[model samples]
Target: MSTPMGRNVIALEWLQFGLGRLVAAAAEEGLTIHLLTGERSEYAHELAELDSPHLVVHDVNTHDVAKVITTIRAIGDVAGLLNTTDTWSLVSLEVRAQLGLAGPDPACIRLVRNKALLRRRLYEHGLSRADGSPLADTDDAADVAARVGLPLIVKDSAGTGSEHVWLARTPDELTAALDEARRVALRGHLIAEPYFLGPLYSVETLTWEGRTRVLGVSSRILSAPPVFREEALAFPVALPPAVAADAEQWIEQVLKCVEYTEGFAHTEFILTDDGFEVVEINPRLGGGLVGEEISQTLDINLYATFLDLVLRRRPALMDAPLTPSRGAAHARLYAPRTGIFVGCQGQELLSGHPGGPVLRPALPAGTAVRTIAHQDGCVAVLFATGATSELALQNVLSAAGEIHVRMEGDDRG
Candidate 1:
């Protein structure tokens, strides 16, 4: 089917941060954006405040796939469907397939949603060295530990944001991790793999009209183990020429193996002594302002580029080769412990500093706080840019140090 021209596009589960940008992009291109989301989304009021004729919000239980499809069909003439959040990718694929819109094959998308399946496909293609196996709920923890060995990572098969991911260094820890995994597994299944010891990185890519291109790479700073939370990220980080080439090659091969021929992908992996150990590939841009950082440093609107791909129009960024003009970094701030939220201080100090970071606070004053165990618990994100990677990273760090969150009922000083 040919792509629809300047028609309505349906976005599954619209929220402020990323989906807002996409909606604005669509509106700018003369396309109407219909945002479908659950009734309870916190950003519902914010979406209403857009007050644009090109944007509309529809409330439905996003988890109810059948009801969602019915609502979309009732609305009629949805030209395309898009989803940046992991929870909505499959739903978007199903909706697009049903609406005869442009998107990757649902089967191909399954390879990304299912972690164990992805790892198996990579191993079959000789693209990864990590060993992983599907775990069962009834399996004995000790026996499973003996089989997979100690110092393993356990996580849900379809989890997102590293939630429910646990690192276990002993049999007892394995049991505890398994219990936690069982609580959060959407499909009641989990996977166990040897814990990789190396620096973690993510490669962002964009595919259009059967061709894929590497957009950029970001180095990750993960919080210490037990639970993995990404604390900071720096993009356009320099890599050895040979290593960069090989990593890009590996990403392309993996895309082929999964038959992912369209859309954006954020592929995470660990740089080991031998080569890249495949982390799960996400079928969207990196979370936490990575796309915004990319747009600022590379001078391209990724959200607009994504719309181009969906409409089957060639993206202009692809026409001319582009590179990062400046280094960019993002750092997230979390509460030190569970308490009653008060406010943050030292914003004035960083506000006038050269290369100061752009701060985005997630919570308001008086909200209850909790000990941050995962990325979802972050309260604010800070983004900064500089002439070089080291300088950008330094700016973000210095800015983070100047800011401090005060909470009631917490005494960690």
Candidate 2:
């Protein structure tokens, strides 16, 4: 393998909502982005449509490590390897390690990718209160229930978007949840843990060379269980000074425990009566326009900061004001029922709304809408800004209420 030093950063996948910002930032920094994605990914066409001189899309099987490495070598002069999505973090890390680039440690990526291992590490470090066990089959559900107790959550050890996650209120429910989880287990193992009831908050942090900085704390709106589908997010949410400090302290400890050296980390936790209990840690930026919301609230461009981190440069904006100049929120719109989508109504009202909420549909018209199960069921996302949190949230709600998806089927309630 020949190493060619080029002004190229290889992104393992490009389907993330924030890829455009990354590409734009890279272009501004006089860098080129070589996006490696599957041939069938919409990103291939999306990148082509951009016609950006700094952006190049390569059709390759990302799952094949050897192929990806070969492609990277063939491109040569690779300055960095990175990914902004959970599904491709490991792949990105592997490529970075193979190429001897700066990134999170491979062992750390392994620990965070496997929920069971993450729980174990946290438990050992006294960072977590809950106990969890890994289940490989339905037969293990009874033992897991006995260990973790009822009202527990059974989920794939490495699942995303709440996929194959189920809440079990009883032993029978536990078994059923295990069965459901087994069907979608990406790693053929399920993790069962006690479910804490409380509001969820995600702490977005950027770590570089082992130094961690908390970017923002965002409150999460989630769909009702047996599935923890995230519905919306409001950023720059106020937290008691002590609570915020403690959450950041915990996040820093987690990064240290996992030996995460660099990159953005999105850590989710429940604000319970006792204290903050960790839910999970995603080694990437928060999804669902979180970076955009943060940018609106704090005047920080996280996508640009991510590029600076990859280049091993200190992000100048890190010292910028952390206080929110304006409140920002993102609300997800889901299809009311399964049907063929015709179009969205009340879009004109949103265009003229006072709060300047931006409405973006996930799927275009003439798309099929299936049962609302996970985040994939979301039809659109409404982004709004206001002088206060209540106003921002209200703006999103008002716009979302007016915009309705016109579907063809009448069977769904």
Candidate 3:
């Protein structure tokens, strides 16, 4: 039996939007969450407001693995931990193993965190797009691009949140992508592989006793081609039950192949004309307010549930069904151009609508902003739940338009 610990630690790198939600969930569950971040983030004030007990904010530089281990030990009796950031997972799992903490197996974590390792494992399990290989150098990238055809994808071996991902169409493009990828690869490791053009989505699941249970699917909206910016996400896909069933089936295989056990897994996949092909799996909740959506609608605090599992507490009984009756849509709001934020226009309007949007904006006025590729300078997020998918989309779009990002930039130029 997994012993449930009354005291828990939430070792967060940064408390932006998602971590904040995790903190709130932990608080609601009557668990103590310790905030851990580097020296630079201004996350303390926001966390202090939560009034969590012994909210020990530590400046454990995640890069220094030694210091991290020391810090974890210092937070004595912190029976279990939950991570809200991707970059911290590798370190967290490593530290957890060293401390005899229970969670997703460390090897499973390694496979999911490293893109190359993930692809290789998925391919071995017959879950990949087709013949693919991890690149060794710029020369290898060019070779793969040619063999895979134009429009190839080059990814970082240990990059998170699509930071070092790129797509190329020609020799020039491939070279440029390789340069950018090399710059962003973690510890300087990169993978160049074939790009699969298709609809992108995420399979959210919670595993217990090795059973991967579905918790709805999210359709991802990308910012632009060749960039990693995720503009939006929606839930309750309109795909027929049969197709969704197939997706669930595929997820089971992925969980087993990757050897993922216990805890949450956010599996990304491309639904192509060929079929569903695996994108890397995240051994945690799908990012971008997914936990919030699940919590609000299904009455499940995924963060709490994760803590419970890690502590070996009795799993939170899900009286509610996983499938949502009405579809929900979440849109990322970014500056149409680039400049310092002057404030969003209609936050009240966006929040006023009862069913229109569940507004969660990370940035407010006076925050410096830019229109960088693969980065949403999101001023706000508009979440809408409606009876039908179209209605939900319309509500979200309407709310998004109402909340305008005021920026000063050379639009004409």
Question: lDDT per model, in order?
Answer: 0.78, 0.78, 0.70
* C-alpha lDDT (0 to 100) for residue 207 of candidate 2: 78
Winner on lDDT (2 vs 3): 2
- List runs of model 2 lying over 4 Å from the truth: 1-5, 39-49, 138-141, 185-188, 408-413
Candidate 3 lDDT, 151-197, residue by residue in tens: 77877777766667778878888888777666652643767666888
Clashes of each: 0, 3, 3
Displacement of the residue 89 alpha carbon in candidate 1, Å? 1.4
Better of 1 and 3 by lDDT: 1
Worst 10 residues of 2 by lDDT: 40-49
184-247: candidate 2 lDDT, tens digit per residue = 5374367787898899999988777788889878888888777688787887777879878888
Instruction: After superposing candidate 3 on the true structure, give the runs of residues whose Cα lies further than 4 Å from its correct spot.
Output: 2-6, 18-29, 39-49, 54-56, 138-142, 183-188, 317-320, 323-325, 337-339, 351-354, 408-413
- Write down the TM-score of every candidate: 0.91, 0.91, 0.88
Q: Give the TM-score of candidate 1.
A: 0.91
User: Which residue runs of candidate 1 sit more than 4 Å off their true CA positions?
Assistant: 14-16, 39-51, 183-188, 364-371, 408-413
